[model samples]
Target: MRSAHRAPRRLTRRHLLGLGGIAAAGVAGLAVQQLRSGQAPAEANTSPGRAAASGAPSPSAAAGPQVVAKGGGTVPYRPGRTILGSYLALEGKAFTESIALRRRQTGRDQRIVHVFYDWTDTLPARIAGLPAGATPLVSWRGSAYSDITSGGSDARIARAARQLKRQGRPLLLRWGWEMNGDWYPWGAARNDKDPGAYVECWRRIHDIFAEEKAKNVSWVWSPNWNSAPVAGWNSFEALYPGDRYVDWVGVSGYNLHRETPDALFGPIYRAFSARKPLMITEVGSMDRGGRTKADWITLFAQWVEAHPAVGGVVWFDTDTHPGYAEKWRIDTDADSLAAYVAMAKSVRFSG
Candidate 1:
């Protein structure tokens, strides 16, 4: 609905932040004028120029599916080249070791790292400190995922989105994650088993970002694997907010009981890959039964290479447990770290 102005595109978070951080201090004065003139920000029309020039139909107009790099930007996903990233800690201050060892082991570094911000505020500097090639994939969560919103709450979401858009580089954002599962209070079941509430909450958050014109974000809609013995089916598809509102379909699946990557991730992959880029956003192979973590890593790597629809893999780098025995940290078992490094080296990861 507005004329577009292109920000200078670059990949580094600091360089983008240097331009004027999240407040967009440098652009604010002009933004006020544009707002008074009833014009939208440039971030709103992010599709590549060729689509308009060539008169070719865009993905949304034609196929009704989305395959974007960031949320609305034109970067495409490359299967084997998707990012190899991690989130060692939710506390933004603690992941330096996660970044350090990764560089040491692979002779390279992570392409991205996961970070979180609560409804109240965020820490952009934490992400700005990542190694040269790494960027942050931030998840914005509030006190409760199911709580719809008040006027002020929407403003919080808008403020965060505006900050990210000011970062200039494309960033990954996971909002209201794992909504299909019953664990987090934000899940649909906790919100009275109302699928519409969940969908509405998601779109509400998405619409705020759009309103703020934060086109740099790539929306990752992640759901946990259906672990409930009987009620899983009713909720998985119901929670999907549709392809139009989603940038990537990510699933948080971990091997709890002697499972392979396919066994753990196949259903979610099959469910959304046809319509969007797939990501094993949060994954781990539990060290259980006589099987080693190395074997699981090997199988997971093979599956990633084989699954063309899979665009990225972000391991649950933390060793925290969910009733599993071994710490899920990649280095816990013998030769497992080596196996992981080999896997990282074997594949091509692009930022």
Candidate 2:
């Protein structure tokens, strides 16, 4: 991990432009002006954003790094190693510790902790407490519309970024992830939604972060794989904000669809090849009614070898946010646990 207090580096306009397909989105000046004016939301629509953590239960800080650190600077994560991770609630340390013990028994060395923070409830407060040298990989705008900005949500985000800059570690900030799918608040799958507006708002947030000299950070652009494809929900790539703004490209998928992992991994890999280093950022085995856990483990290993560009995968291991078939409780499968360890020892992001 890099230090957060280092002097900031300016990302040249040309540098950002070369990232990909961004100019077509016309992202300049849109979000900044909205913030300068301090426009308030007059009428909150049914589809508009929600206040922070409105419906979700308060997270307990029991979750911790599954694989305890042997030393500082770098833990034992590598490519091909099974990444034994979970979508951890920021407050749950006990749950994290238990999960960590289970992973250790299987010999898994990598553990990626995920925190889904509500933009309205979490963004301001959480960023304010970022410790020195710790730039957290925050998944922003979960289960709420309050953080979803059409144009006016810039100042708040700027404040958050400033706090993150003080933390000194390069922040792997993944905002409004899985936006191309309709399952969450930020998704573009419903109502006369505008991908253009989404892109415009995304750029504004990016610009604000940049302006704050939040240089110790990289942006990850993610979207869900639309199974049972809807009319506009064919693929997430169509809603891509452009290459310039994205450092990592990922998809949220599981193994329950009619399409097998062998069949599904390749096309997505090919499509996102335009951007190097892809990930099944969120994954699990869904459906498979009464299927033994061993089967899913086999499928997981096979999926990784089949797709080399898939640099990492963060398994969602909670009993909530059920996917199509709902496999959150599949963590009990011993075979799956072994597979996770085997893969974590081999595949890690060294760069």
Q: Kindly list the per-residue Cα lDDT of model 1 for residues 1-351, writing each as its tens digit.
A: 000111112212221111110122223344344447664321211111111111111233355433333332332466447678876642232456656766777777877677755556652523545677565677665346434554546766776777887777777887767665545556665666676767777888889889988877788887764422124332556778887888888777665443445545655665566667877777775564333567667657766776767777887675432232346567775567877887788745543
Q: Highest TM-score: give the candidate number.
A: 1
Off by over 4 Å in 1: 1-75, 90-94, 123-126, 142-146, 149-152, 227-234, 289-291, 320-326, 348-351
What TM-score would each prediction reach against the true structure? Answer: 0.72, 0.64
Q: If candidate 2 were superposed on the true structure by all CA atoms, what would the RMSD be?
A: 17.7
Q: Residue 303 of model 1: what lDDT?
A: 69
User: lDDT of candidate 2 vs native?
Assistant: 0.47
- Tell how far residue 9 is off in model 1, in angstroms: 38
Model 2, 9-111: lDDT tens per residue? 3322221111111111111232233335662111111121111111112223463212211111112223333334545321233444644554456454224
